[model samples]
Target: MYRYDEFDATLVAERVAQFRGQVNRRLSGELTEDQFKPLRLMNGVYLQLHAYMLRVAIPYGTLTSQKMRKLAHIARKYDKGYGHLTTRQNIQFNWPALVDVPDILDELAEVEMHAIQTSGNCIRNTTSDQYAGATAEEVEDPRPYAEMIRQWSTFHPEFSYLPRKFKIAVTAADRDRAAVKFHDIGLRIHKNDAGEVGFEVYVGGGLGRTPFVGPTIREFLPKEYLLSYLEAILRVYNQQGRRDNKFKARIKILVNSEGVDGFANLVETEWNQIKNSGVDLPREEIDRIHAYFASPKFENLSGESKTHKAKIAEDKEFARWARTNLAEHKTSGYSIVNISVKPIGGIPGDISDIQMEAVADIAERFSFDEMCVTHEQNLVLPHVKKDDLFAVWSALKAVDLATANIGLVSDIIACPGLDYCSLANTRSIPIAQRIAERFSDFQKQEDLGELKIKISGCINACGHHHAGHIGILGVDKKGEEFYQITLGGSGAEDAAIGEIAGRGFSSDQVVDAVEKLVDYYKNNRQDKERFLDTYRRLGAQPFKEALYDAA
Candidate 1:
């Protein structure tokens, strides 16, 4: 909902022109592929397994109706007829020709959108809670602060190219929907004992070949000092982080090598120098940025609309969809609706061009023309009225978007694995599809309760397998694909990395292995306990015994 100012418009236009020239040079053979690699990466272009992939940044995952339509247009006009929503709250078109990328940028810039800073070692898109403004229990909206960081980090001279890419996430809700603990920097906005608003800062969390749940360096940083503190942290990492080996170049590696206390001391030393050097935003500027994220006007209505209840009673199918898809809203008589992109046995996070256009229309009509993409690979209608639930469900069903499997086993988060990614070890999409089909029964999924299954093609952790209740990572053995499973990881308020169960399974054996894990959980869980709760209460021993001992 934030409109591009004159400065923003000019910056994007200029970047596109510059990238166009760079693309032409590579195409003309004036610059070799080695020479063009870094230049193209800076503009959000990547050389994937099949072709070039253009990752367009959707800052904070927020999109207007017009912007959403343009995305559909790009998918239809350019490469394939679909786009992949990634774990970082951005979208990737996996098969764009190198020549057409600049034209794609030209199209995106028309809608005030671009792919700049979406790649490279610079601070990537700053993600936040998808339901920031619409949720009922948020301490405050986190988008304004996320926007502040985005503006500060964009093309920042000091930290543009770190030892490795850096990521930051923000959350203001009671629950950690943004996966704050698994980011390079996670900011949770909260109130102090004296009613002052500030942030709880977690640093050095990341997932890849090596994974760690970041440590909390500062328990409470005053909101005004946010930028200065971030600057200090980046300064420490930029100066001391490892660059000799790409594997150990992340801030997480640096944080662990220095020890948590040692890293905190270093950051403190840096903070003392520039905490008052005008690095932070002024109060008036903060207010101006926040005004763009103000809540829309709502008509006061009582909770639990009678019309919604009546429709639920009249339509059993509608009631079933509502049970899983609708969430509580801060405004009375409204709901936060999640449209799961993971249709039964379909590819996870892949939405077709027509589906995209349909979602745009639904948001335009029922949800204040505002929608957001979730890190779980779903589209959210953040401000839908309770009385309009039936109509929204109908529209979604018409486009095959009503899946009723939000948080169920079939609602998977999978990267475009061997099918698309050059770095993949196995085909993750097929494994996800098999699992979804095995658990395709709606009643079975409902009985299984809140289960999150995340599958990654490799150790890059693009699918966030490290944080799943049941995690699967693909590996290579004897020229064959295999999968490794982990249990009891979470990305919520109580964040923790998952523990590996045991040995790996073949591509054919992986789905059965996942089912066995679910079966163990379902058979042994206490009353109303989730899979994570059951796994935590009991240890990995029980699940491991159920899996390998049976084999």
Candidate 2:
């Protein structure tokens, strides 16, 4: 994790002071709702369907024990007893009073965290692969570049207000876990034949009313010109991106309108002037930022853990968990343990204050006092010893956190839908709860094998429904909640968008619809094909027939 420097601390403190005055003015009635809308939004405060919601940034989804404890404190003091981890890997408190927002910001500043640029059409939080620093397959840690971009885009005077919200993701690994292709700007970091680091930049990818898989604008942008290249792309979009209709204002639409060739030409023309400007990254500066993410110390241990094998042999439940929850770490004896937050029938990403504290304790005890938040919305202790599996699982089970459903049918990615979100047309949490309850049988879930079920309240794809093997989108039809299902989508090395199966189902029928789809895949799939492979080979037509057979 990148520790806040003096400049970072000073800027956040100043923003807190500035927002305090803004909150005071709004409450004093000096600023009406109309007048306060933009101000509050800029500060990441929203007057949602109910009370105000505050989204606090968890930059690149990395958290310290201190920071996680601070979040627990904020949850207990400000709104509710829980905080919802969002699709972007940030956390949101759904029920905060507007008057106490400045105080919340003050509390956040205590931990060197804030809500700046988290909302209001500005460049949002820069997201990277949640497993950035720990994954065994990574070429390098991508967080330093993410941190640099975060600072540069925080309040870039030029892009503070744009046609629509802009998102950027960087991944240094060969596999794309950050959903980079679905971002406004996606940077794939690589080293050229000359052993020089650079990025392959993709632009105009986004998911909203208009979803697009971004196109490559620059095949290889040198490391020094990364920021400048980004500036050029945004500069082109900010000036010429549509503003007439909010629906068509995204950079995706702009790129589509101009065609990839025309857009590339525009960016090239703009980049030529700014490539070697003040923003050009120096080698020393990149190395300095990279220093913060250096790997933790590890003991020299053998390839396999005899203790771990013994534990797995002793406990079947532990074996199941170990199989699903543990990921390979770069080090020989260390493992990346994903402490499942999705207990059966529990909210997908809601971690209570006690759980938060427990996680902090575990991070300090088991990990090197570090944790990472997964894109699937799970907490990760990145450097757990292979020998500590049982101890970690035992501690996690005590807190009701050990649910062996990682990558299984019950391991769903869901948003805090209509229940908390004003923008939602229907409830997503209850739907997710229903699905979990339906697949209550762990044996059945394990038999069904690796299946991803993602739910979203709206078409914004916050739940990443577009990338799920089984995608569920909730819509409201004449005051009744309905859900639409899509299959075959994936967010992995072989990424592909999901295709809708058929007509939408009522809330009650949605779970049954999902169950039917799984059954069909089970009966039709080849020997070891996952649900995605089955759907791809069979296509939506077969699934569509099966889904709407009796309709």
Candidate 3:
């Protein structure tokens, strides 16, 4: 993790003082609700349906034990005793008092964290793969690039107020764990034929009222010109993107209207003028950022852990968790452990204050004093020793944090929905809870295999409903909530927006509908095919028929 320099510390402290004054002005009636809207949004404070919400940015989803403990402290001191992890790998406090927000910001600054750019129409937090440097398959660690962008975009006067909020994601792994394709700008780091590293840049991919997979504007951009190229793209969007209608303001809408070729031409023309400008990252600067993300020291253990193998054979519960929640590490003696926040029948991504502190303790003790927040609403102890797996699992179990459903059906991604969000039409948490409860059997979930269920309370797609293998969207009809189902959507390397099955289901009927679709796939799938694979082979017709025809 990167420590804040003097300049960074000064900037954040000044911003907090500024926001504190602004908050006081609003409370004193010097600024009305409309007047305070932009100021509060710039600081990541939102007036939700029930109370004020504060969204704290977890840059590229990486955090140290110190920062994690601060989050636990914030959750305990202010708000309720828990915080909700967002699909963008941020955390949200849904019940903060309006007057307490400035104090919260001050506390966050002490830990080198802030809530800036989390809610405004400016550039939001740049996210990346949770297993960035530790995973075995990455072409290069992408966090340094993400950090560079974060520095460039933070309070950049040119892009402070765009037509709509912009999101950027980067991934270096073959598997797109960051869901880069669904971002406003997605960057894939890879090596070229000549073995030089570069980026595959995708623009205009987003999901809201309109869903799109952003087209690649450049097949390969030299690593040196990364910042310059990004500047060019943002310049093009800032000058020409829609401003008349809020609904049509996103860059995705602009990309759709101008076509990929036209947009690419504009960006390339802008890039040609600025490609060699001073904004182009110098080699030393890049190296400096890269140094912050260099791998931690690992003992030279030449083989797999004998104790780990024995433990798996001895304890069925630990064995089940290991099989589902662990990923291979580049280091032979270490494993990447994913801690599921989505316990069976619990609100997806909700971690209590005690759980946060417990995980932070475990991270310090077992995972090199670091933790990561996954886009799928889970936590990762990226470098756990294989020999200490049982100890870590036992610690997590004591805190009620050890649930083995990482990618299974019960590992749902859901938004706050009507419970807190003013823009939501229905409740998303209950739907996720019902579905998880219906499929609580761990054996059954594993047997069904790799089913991703995402739910959004509205069409905004905050839960990334468009990217799930089985997506559920909540819609309002005649003042009543109804759930709509989509099948075959995926947020992987081969990304696809799910297609709608048919008519919507009542709240009472949605869970059973999901069950039917799962049963249909289980009965029809070819040998060991996942839900997504089977859906692709059989198409949506069978699943649609299974959901609607049987209803």
Model 3, 1-551: lDDT tens digits are: 77788989999999999999999999999999999999999999999999999999999999888999999999999978999998788999999888999999999999999999998899999999999989979998899999999999999999999999999999998899999999999999999899999999999999989999989989999888999999999999999999999889999999889999999999999999998779877889888888998899998775588899999999999999999999999998899999999988899999999999999999999999989999998999999999999999999999889999999999999999999899999999999999999999999988888999999999999988999899999999899999999999999898999999989999999999999999999999999999999999988788888887749
lDDT winner, 1 or 3 = 3
Clashes of each: 0, 0, 1
Displacement of residue 359 (Cα, Å) in model 3 is: 0.8
Candidate 2 least-lDDT 10 residues: 488-497
lDDT of each prediction vs. the true structure? 0.92, 0.87, 0.93
Task: At residue 382, give the lDDT of candidate 3.
Answer: 96
lDDT of 1 by residue, 428-463 (tens): 999999999999999889998999999999999888
Residue by residue across 44-125, what tens digits does model 2's lDDT show?
A: 8887788899999999999989999999998998878898887777888989898889999988988889999899889999
RMSD values, in order shown: 0.8, 1.3, 0.7
Q: Which residue ranges in model 1 land beyond 4 Å of their true spot? A: none
Candidate 1, residue 63: lDDT: 90
